[model samples]
Target: MKLLSAFAASLLWAIPAQGQTDPSQAALEAAAMLEQASIALTEADSARDRVRALTGTIQAYEAGLAAMREGLRKAATREAQLTAELRAREKDVAQLLGVLQTIETTAPPVLMLHPSGPLGAARTGMMLSEVTPGLNAKAEALAKDLQEVQTLRILQQNAADTLTQGLSGVQDARTRLSEAIADRTDLPRRFVEDPVRTAILISSTETLDGFASGLAEISEGEIAETDASISDRKGDISLPVQGILLHRAGETDAAGVTRPGLVLGTRPRALVASPTAATIRYRGPLLDLGNLVILEPQPGLLFVFSGLQEVYGEPGQVIPEGTPVGLMPGETPEIGAILSTTSDGTGTDRSETLYIEVRQDNSPVDPESWFRTDKDG
Candidate 1:
């Protein structure tokens, strides 16, 4: 859970040190800022979604390529079988030719019109009838083998073409995702140019408590506003990252310490987005946590997320729903991690966990109470 200390240290000291004189005016300004942030967040989200969709497409293509290669292998095996059969048929024909040669030194027409007489003619007719059926059957089998070989070759070529196209599609998706990440203009900021104040805040806070107190003082001047309250969207908000829910609020661990929020196991380098538009409460390293972010969906409710390798927005910024806030640390999957929506055994490779805390009136609340999806532990 993010207490006063983590909140203070991670956030920028942009809120005026002195309190605002007109609370109503400050609230109006805050609302206006949120509106701007919401607009920017919407634009950023659209771009991010496009990139995410492309990544999914690339992964799907990779799965398809694997299947196609397996099919091609099976087809090639069939072709080999047909080739072997054709060679055996050819050997049988050669043996039959040798027998025919030993039977008579004359051509087929001569044998049919032999100079010997009716007895010789009747003997030739019986021999011819016996040999004809075998020759015709051999010819028919050879034709079928040749046709099958042609079909397999065609299938192999088509599969190769499909794999090539799939590769190209994946590359395109990667390029677009990179471009979307680079575009950050749509993000709205709460901090203007206060480098000196930020530096002083960083230097002054040595302990978590001091940091929290300092931040509380700084935030006294700012106002909080949102279109909807956290309580208003209970059980309908999407998760910040795609993954399996590992734990739920009040769940105890091996140490017998009960958790105050949800723990999710997700893909490496997975994109983390804001479940809803809210002010950036905190964004930086917290004690024992890698990189953490806290959001204020409304004045009394705080949503805390930690375990990111890189962070995007600042403490004073307002972010849109679905706007990417950070990425988990680790190498992205080669075929892109599977993000199956269903509980089927399709995606089972998630290896990282994100800690999510929902606090109301500074007390930890059950996050499952607000999520649309069901929780695990």
Candidate 2:
């Protein structure tokens, strides 16, 4: 029995820690993504289309950071589970240790001798052989659990640095993207925006419905018509930004205000893009809805997005699908806050909200019906 215990201990000690042998897949993928984003950033400086290149870099960084956050969350959850299991088996472990110690200290001659005689001693030896394998298996399993707990702790500690780099890279990409958009004057124009008419329209309208109904009055020239029609693609479009659906249209808020729009919970400074190729009918501050961008995908259809910190593109420019439209307003959480929130599993990291409203033929429609809501941000 003592020999068996020693062998088990040696095997356990020989087993490598899981973290050293098999790092978290999510973490590895995230690191790869971040590395690619860094390379993209460097290449964007010389790219012919800096806006497009920077946009891709920002997206890569976002994906990497999201993966890292998920990896940390899983690691934290696994660590907690292992800790709890260890605590629950504390008495069992103590008893197992005591048994091992007793077997180690006992003299082999005495252990082999049975009071009944040679027959009892032979039976006892058989019983010991039968139990040894079970004990060794349990000991090895326990060792693995303990090692995994230690590994998870190390993984989380190392995640902070990777997350910081990802966050910094994304911010830099966003800044460059903004500069690129500003310097861009090559996008096709549908019409020149008449600021005076647009102001009059805003001043004259008290609600979104009114403003949208009069969108045609602000164009200074004949609007260039495009064949772009998303009518067949209704109910299959992606959301303008990566986020969680907070509230459906007509859901009342804490302030008791109800509006016909879908509310999305997004992270701070999250990128917002156009889901389809559309002409920018309007882009600016309007009413009490911070910064807004209105896109006319077709003559009778309009997509309204509000609660932005920065808006992109000219009022009458025709932008391609997936163009960066704006950014959500809020300070990015620090590394410590992100890790704390992830471990706590409160999902409070998404602190900003984006409001989306879809209108067809001058009537409000459920945004959910038009946008795919099953995807994770």
Candidate 3:
């Protein structure tokens, strides 16, 4: 029983937050929600359609990862090749250094000893040409080659370092793309389902009904109801919207079959119409009200008209009385009166008629008293 009680309470709250607050706030919130839903659904479709884009991005990332790995492999290979080449160059330099040391230590003194005289070494050169004629030049050339190889090693190390950093950046990008794909898949649904966020959607239907009722201020600071006098109301007197003008003033408990008024095509957007405008309270693409508008002239007194071809304005737009709100685009019922024919027992012809209603304090009220000569509606 306790669980059931809790369930019932929750269900009640989950239903429309009834009563009234600021009409503009309610209308704006509802329309905004609808618009948001529309946009979200549109984005969802785009995302679904562009699943291929995400797929392509994923594939590209994979390919790039492969290419990065291959690049790193090549860098390592080049580094190894450079190391091997440097080792071989070092060995050649070491062998040349040894030969240079030997030649430096032994060549000059021996040549001096063997020459007939220091100045007459030309004769000794003829004898020593096979051993040491170009030994000094060979030592100098080997030293230069060793220095060049050391410089080449430094350059190779820098190149390898740069390649390593590049590979890391590519890997990071791949991870980010994967996360983005997941977020796009799940975020919108979760955002929409959040209880606090979804509460508005749950209340949408009832709120829509209130919106259909045209009163802007259902309850003032403390008044159960307040009626704005005709003097205070501002509307296009010449071209009032032609539709059933539902009246609440001077109405009884049961006002039925009131004359239908011709609600014009002009109506304030649902979000901002004055209470007196019989403004479309709530509108949507519904069955009979096909993009219908609800107008409330007084509390509990609502005029629901359906089958409008198009809607104008937004949730809280205050419009004049004669604004063309919409068209009767649906099949309306026709009135018929039976007549006794001389030849036939009875005959009846389908004739056009209008649906009408009046209410007071949210209850139906008689329209015969409130109508201005039955011509204003």
Q: Provide the TM-score for each candidate, comma-separated.
A: 0.49, 0.88, 0.25
lDDT of 3 by residue, 1-377 (tens): 23323322322212114573422233234333333333333343346533333333333332332232233333334445546654765754454456546556776767456435755666545544533434445444444434544543454344333334333332343343334433443211101113332234434435333433323432222322336244333232222232333333333323352223332222111111122454334444643334655555544555554444544433333344443343333322111110011012111111112223344555544434344434432
Worst 10-residue lDDT window for candidate 3 reads 334-343
Clashes of 1: 1
- Local accuracy of candidate 1 as per-residue lDDT tens digits, 1-377: 12322322322122224552332233233333333433433343355455445444433443443344334444555567667765765645455444445445757666677568877788767866665555445445555557768876665554434444444554454455556656546666554424455456657777433444444344424444445566677888888876778777778755686678877887666667788888876677766667888787777777888899877665667777766677777764342221111112333556678888877767777887877556321
As a TM-score, model 1 comes out at 0.49
Task: Report the error of model 1 at residue 80, Å.
Answer: 22
Model 3, clash count?
46
Worst 10 residues of 2 by lDDT: 12-21
The order of the candidates by TM-score, greatest first, is: 2, 1, 3
Question: Where does candidate 1 clash, by residue pair?
Answer: 235-370
Model 2 lDDT per residue over 1-377, tens place: 45554544543423335464243566677778888989999999899988888888888888788777877777777788779877976867766666667666889888889889999999878867776666666776787788878888888888888888888899999999999999998899889999999999999999999999999899898888777788888899999887888888999987788999989988889999999999999999999998999998888889999999999999999998889999999998889987886734454677899999999999999997788998858
Flag the better candidate by lDDT, 1 or 3.
1
Give residue 312's error in model 2 in angstroms: 0.7
Pick by TM-score: 1 or 2, better one: 2
